[model samples]
Target: MFNDISGKYDFLNHLLSFGIDKIWRNKLLGSITFASDSKVLDMATGTADVALQIAKEKGVEVTGADISDGMLDVGRVKVKTKKLEDLVQLVNGDAENIPYEKETFDIATVAFGVRNFQDLPQGLIELHRVLKADGQLRVLEFSKPKSSFVFWFFGLYFNRILPFVGKLVSKNNTAYRYLPVSVNAFPEGQDFCDYLRNAGFTEISFKPLTFGISTLYICKK
Candidate 1:
């Protein structure tokens, strides 16, 4: 499903979120505290947006790993276009089995990608395995709003307008339709934080972004 929509993934993403996605990504980058020479692993890195941003902001060497070669193809083009080939690399790999040695990365990140994992716990464990001791891990994901009105509005938009527009633009009805269903079914807030703890990450904290439409989770190994 993801491979099929790779071409339109970034396009519909920016469109469906009204460009707020970029702002959110920037915020996630800002929250990251890393050394200049940090080696970062971006898992499930669709189009390498976060990985590129990390390199641009922190001058870190970034490796982006994703299961979809089609998505990595798009990300590679962007890296070339930005002249970041020296700093950023994209790999076709799964989150549940990162193709790297243990304790390799200084930082790990996933942007709106964890919910798509076939086995979330296995993916989290893999992330933990590759991260250096005391390394930082940041994750961005969709969440339900706390306010009733906002929740209702977001629900309507996601359940109705988003799927319609996503299908029209991406030409993948099932994929877009699955978006809302997945978000709705995925655990959020403290429930998700507890999952992180179970995966062996400590100092877990989450911050709601953009009126609680999404959340940024920070954890430590």
Candidate 2:
């Protein structure tokens, strides 16, 4: 599904979010802390936007893993174009069954990808396993708006306009349609925090962004 729309994914993301996604990612970046030699794993990295952003750190190493080769191909091009090939590497992998050994990364991140996990708990556990003892995890994902007025307007835009625009741009009928369905079904807010706690994370918390249209989850192990 992702591979089918990989070419148009980045374009549609910026268009649909009105470029607010970058701000959201920056917010996640603010909460993450690591050493000069720290290694970061970006799970379900899609086109590696998060990986690319983290690679800006002077000596940070980023590994971007995703299930779709097409997305990785586009991400690799971006990395090469940015001359960040030495700091960032893209790999093909699954979220539920990551190939890395335990305690490999000082930080782990998932941007707008946790909702797509086939097994949410298993995926979270895998992320936990790959993190060092004091590793931090940050996840950025779509969430339902809290205010009634915002919820009504956002719902109209999401359920009506967003999917229409997505289909028009990507030419993939089912992919965009599945987006809202998945977000609605996903456990957001504290319900989601429970999953993080169950996955062996401590000091877990989340902050809503853009009037709750999205959320950034922070946790430590």
Candidate 3:
């Protein structure tokens, strides 16, 4: 499913969000306390946007792991084009079964990716295992708005408008429709915090972004 739409993924993301996705990504970047020689593991790293951004901003090395070859192929082109090949590397791997060893990374991140995990708990645990002691995990995901009006408006756009635009642009039918279904099925806010807890994460903070159109989960291992 992902492979089929990989080419249009980045384009549709910016277009659908009206370029607000960069702000959300920046918010996640702000949560990190970058250091010299810091190693980052970006799980479910479609096209390596966060990884590439981190390397450009902090000059840190990032390993982006995802299951989609088509996505990685696009990412590699961008990496080489930007001449960030030295800092950013994308691999074919899964969140539930990461290729790296335990305690390998100083930080881990997933932007709008956790809910797509086949085994959410196992993915979280694997992320925890790869983080060094006291390492932080930053996550960005969609969430329901607290306000009734906003929730209704948000639902209307997500369930109706966004999917239409997505399919028209991406030329894939099921991919766009599946997005809202996955987001609706995902456990957000406190329920999601419980998953982090079960995965041995602490100091968790669930901060809503853009009136709860999205959320940022910051946690420590």
Give lDDT tens digits, candidate 2, residues 124-221. Answer: 99999999998999999999999999999999999889999999999999888899999999999999999999999999999999999999999999
User: Model 3 scores what on Cα lDDT?
Assistant: 0.94
Question: How many clashes (backbone atoms < 3 Å, residues ≥3 apart in a chain or on different chains) does model 1 have?
Answer: 0
Q: Which has the higher lDDT value, candidate number 1 or candidate number 3?
A: 3
RMSD of each: 0.7, 0.8, 0.7
The candidate with the higher lDDT, 1 or 2, is 2
Q: Can you write out model 3's per-residue Cα lDDT over 168-210, one digit (the tens) per residue?
A: 9889999989999998999999999999999999999899999
Residues 27-75 of candidate 1 have per-residue lDDT tens digits of 8898888897899999999899999988887888999999999899999
Sort by lDDT, top down from the best:
3, 2, 1
The local lDDT score (0 to 100) that residue 198 gets in candidate 3 is 99
TM-score of each: 0.98, 0.98, 0.99
- Which residue runs does candidate 3 get wrong by more than 4 Å? none
Stretches of candidate 2 exceeding 4 Å from the true structure? none
lDDT per prediction? 0.93, 0.94, 0.94
